[model samples]
Target: MEHRELGNSGVEVSEIGFGAWVVGTDWWGDRSDEQAVGMVEEALDAGVTYVDTGDVYGHGDSEEIIGKAIDGRRDEVTLSTKIGYDFYDNPQAGHGELPKELNREYLTEAFEASLDRLDTDYVDVLQLHNANVDEVTPEVRDLLREWKESGRVRALGWALGPSIGWLAEGDAAVEYEEFDAVQTVFNLFEQEPGRHFVETIRDSGPDTSVIARVPHSSGLLNEQVTPDTVLEDGDHRSHRPKEWYETGWEKVDAIRFLEDPDHADGTRTMAQAAIRWLLAHDEVASVTPTFRDGDDIAEWSAAADVPPISEAEYDRLEGLYARNFDIDRDDGMDVLRTSVDGEDIEAAGLDKRAASY
Candidate 1:
């Protein structure tokens, strides 16, 4: 399961993908569209060829249970979804926040209704769901470059959030160098706006690539929410604020030194060292991680053949996330959500408290 290429969009994907938003959502708990098509056929028998998903998640019923779990293997999967959520005239009040509609005739009738609920004929990454830097206009960037020059999307992204900091809609979709990817909420304890959209796409250039969603910071880098975990009722991490899981379980024990077990390539599971600390970011091509079943999709789709977090454990996780993880306190995400009025979260230095969107 090592794939890769979303940036130079020759379109690969599976370096541990499959976040079907916990398929047809109980917001990540219940499961039973035959256990969500047997947890996406046990993440396609563990090779996990990328799944994603979000046409307002359960509203389109998680792309119709990932089109019945990739019926007849659909060329062994690499799907991906997402379309700005109007939820077709909004009614979903429970998990709230709908109403988005990124123009171009409601994103071409919501990408042909997400290709008729992912029965598919296109879609290997489409994205734009949580869109908001003035809703990516210019006719939604020429209708996403005419659906990737007419193949109907082999790549194109932007899924920033319904929660974490938008960081000016991921720095205006990587400064509009026509994104090849962007999805956010990166892990090893929520690094700001996915390390400020991978350093604003490597100090300003394109080849976007960075699809890491909540790589387990919700479950605290994969200890599955400990400190006597009890987040039950409607658990979208129970709307996060028990001091953000007690300051994320003490920043997951100060990065448990990225868990090892005599690793020349064998034992590594703090959920595969929190997905090898976001694939130690060479622009993080993929790392979806929310697979809540089939033994969490056979231990994180074998975390793409583990053993990667090295460079001296990613420089001791960038000095334990520049010392915040050593546990001082307030990781209750200091009020985020900003847009141009906050001047792109104060030109991305991000001291927080903007909250406008």
Candidate 2:
């Protein structure tokens, strides 16, 4: 697997990282502990050296599963996890609308709990889960700095929440310089915020890395969902409007050129093509593709070996994004209202600036 340094932190992570959100909960489906651990082991065997999980994921069950999976091979991977949610008090905060708590006492206690759950002394990368731009206050920055100085976390980042492309937060993260990376939802379909985030980091100083989550456009790029497909009740995608699948498939078909072997210069699956499209950018440090089982783990982990999409193909995608191509361009702010129950965008202090397209 090809590894890249996470910003200037000197922490090398595999091009394809393991996303542990699905395994920890039935949000995707009911996965047994053995099934979850087996998948992580399979990912490790396939050369995935970075694992991204959150404390709120299955209410810390995800971290415990990871702790067990990497029991004897902790050194083989760089563990990255998120905090800043009060999941400890209210485990069922509903999807994407977890209450934020960034005070020092809350943060310190949260870090300790995460370490205990992961069976590790220090997390390689610690992130503020789903924080808004204004939420990343001076107090939060100082606490993260203290954590780094005290060796609780090697590097720090902001994992944009309620969906990707929080332009204000992404810009502030890069300018802050304390952040080593920023995680966003960047895939073949949802490309704006991730693209803008990468450009801003490159143009600015501090060498912040970009971690692309939802690299498959929530399974559209993964080819696991079709227009006819119906998601299960517990599945996270089930919450999205039916229009999301109908419109998403249209957008997916528009980018079918990415899957052409000739354009890719070699044989590549649609999913790998999607991931390589993101990896083509020099600023993307890692792309975490969600996996369901050992087989899924192997398939995505090998995506890193596929030849990159040519610059011409990359430009084609850029042009498609510019045209919008019948895709909804709400800047992903609708995610806050639709994905979670009772989420108030205005109450969250998110307005036009936060959802700038």
Candidate 3:
């Protein structure tokens, strides 16, 4: 596994990191504690040195499992987890409307709880879980700054959106020098805020990094889910309307050219191709791909070894993005618009009525 530095925090992480959402929640499926812990062990054994989780995942059961999984190997990985949801008040909050607590007291309690759950003294990276631009106030910034300086958190990042509606929030947060990274949904298809975020970070002259989440376009780019693939009722993907699958497959087919082995000297799989496409950019520090088991972990962890796509292919993707793949609809397009001076502006042509990916 190839490792990269996470901005200027002096922390190094594997190119492929493990996303612990599925193992912690029935939102993906019912995964037993044994299976969940084993999967984390498998990922670590396979050289995945970064693990991303949230306190709200499975109502904090995910963090508990991670604590157990890394019992003897705590030093082997850089643990990254999120806070900001007031799960203590309403543990059963829906995915869309989890109430937030940003005051100093709540943040202090949340961080201590997260550390206890992970069995660690300090988190390598702590993020504000899907906070809006307005919610990231001066008070919040000072609180995080104090924590980092005190050695409680080595780095700080802002998770862009709960879905795709918070693009402006992402753009605004990247300008802050205190943040070492920004986690955004950037894959083969949903490159809106990701592209704009990357460009913003570069222009600002900060050593900030971009953590690319949903690097597979929610499984489309990975070729794991086809048009006919049916998700179980409890699966989060099932919440997406039927139209998402239909329209998503069309967009996936449009980018089939990327699957050609010639693009990366024949070593890349469809999934690796999707991840490499994001890593091709200099701003991207890590790609957190969701994994179900050891096989999934091994496949994605090896993507770092695949040769990167040529510059010509990267330019072609840019052109395709500018045209929105001619999909004829505006659902998954990255319509995040901002001012030249880096001020937040309302994005036009964004289909707010459509279900976000």
Error of 2 at 349 (Å): 19
lDDT of 1 by residue, 1-357 (tens): 778887777888878888887878787777679888888887888888888888888788889888888988988898988888887787887887887878898889888988888888798788898878887878889879888888978888888878877787777777675678888887866678788888878877548888888888778777888888888767778888888888878777767656663447577778888887788788888888888877778888877777777777787778887877678778666676765567777876776667776
Considering only N, C-alpha and C atoms within 3 Å, which residue pairs clash in candidate 3? 192-334
CA deviation > 4 Å runs, candidate 1:
1-51, 54-69, 72-80, 84-101, 120-127, 136-158, 161-165, 168-183, 194-256, 260-267, 275-297, 301-319, 324-344, 347-357
Worst 10 residues of 3 by lDDT: 334-343
What ranking emerges by lDDT with the best candidate at the front? 1, 2, 3
Between 1 and 3, whose lDDT is larger?
Answer: 1
**Every model's TM-score:** 0.34, 0.89, 0.90
In order, candidate lDDTs are 0.80, 0.80, 0.79
What lDDT is reached at residue 124 by model 1?
78
Across 1-357, the per-residue lDDT of candidate 2 in tens digits comes to: 999988898888899999998778887778789989998998998999899999988889999999999999999989999998897776474565667788889988988899999999989999998787666789989889988898878888888865554566766778887889989888877665677777777778547999998888777888898866778766777766766667777888887876665653567788888889889988999999888877677777888877788878878777887676656544333432222222323434443233332
lDDT string for model 3 (1-357, tens) is 888887788988788888888778876557789999999999999899898898988878999999999998988988999999998997574455578888889988998999999989998999999876767889999999999999989989888767654666666666688888889888877776677777877887657888998898777888778976877765666666666667778877777776675644566777888999998888888899989777788888888777787788788877887676777764534344332223343342343233322
TM for candidate 1 is 0.34
lDDT, residue 245, model 3: 66
lDDT of 2 at 100: 79
Which candidate ranks first by TM-score, i.e. highest?
A: 3
